[model samples]
Target: MEEIFENRGLGLGLSFSGLNGIVTYYDYNLDDNQQLHYSLELTGQQVGNSFKALRLTEESTDMQSISKSGSGNSLEIDRILVSGTYRWFVDESLVWGISEGLFYGAGGGFGYSTLKYQGERYKYGSQHIR
Candidate 1:
């Protein structure tokens, strides 16, 4: 079967007071003899230091598939995902000068995902911190 796909995206960034921010958007499309797919995504992030930062992302996808040779059955799927993250920077100094300007940190993120397929819906989520 013949298949084709295309994608487009744009991004912007800014920085101030040791804080940096970025935003991006993407669009995607696909077509095939028995399937069609489309997707969109938006992502953003802010970073102030090696030890502290934040991130956010969201995505949506749609897909349709049909059987060409068997019963002509068709199936459709739609999915969405959202996620976020936070990070902290830790700095340690030693008198022996063995460790200088070293960056270390621990952080956790949470995410959620949903799917709709064949008239059925499913949802999932998670969260954690450290």
Candidate 2:
């Protein structure tokens, strides 16, 4: 004899002030008895003055899973990641007076990630500027 289970999910988002964001979360179990769970978020924004505009964005994700091994043992894994960036730009027509319809910008960002499995943890991260 055998049995089965199923699951489904849906998500929605709203934004204001030239900024938008969305988040989603889901969890489900597989037929083999593995369990999975995860969440994700994303956001973006743009603000401007007469001379320049600023743009920003960010994203994050987390996930975990547990499963039974061939030896009938349970194993679990977890992971997380986060990152963001920003930029400033000026219209080429305003700086060069050529009206070629272009812009220049500089940006920077950073990111970090971590993972855990079988009583051990690992981490990674980075940063940048331009």
> How close is every model to the real structure, measured as TM-score?
0.22, 0.22
Worst 10 residues of 2 by lDDT: 45-54
lDDT of 2 by residue, 19-54 (tens): 233445554533222334444543321111211222
1-130: candidate 1 lDDT, tens digit per residue: 9865644334443332212233333322222111122222322221222113233212221122211123433343222223332222233433237544333333343333332224323468788888
lDDT scores for all predictions?
Answer: 0.30, 0.35
Stretches of candidate 2 exceeding 4 Å from the true structure: 1-5, 8-10, 13-20, 31-34, 46-130
- Predicted candidate 2, C-alpha RMSD: 24.3
Candidate 1 positional error at 116, Å: 6.8
**Alpha carbon RMSD to native, model 1:** 22.8
lDDT of 1: 0.30
Stretches of candidate 1 above 4 Å error?
1-62, 66-69, 88-130
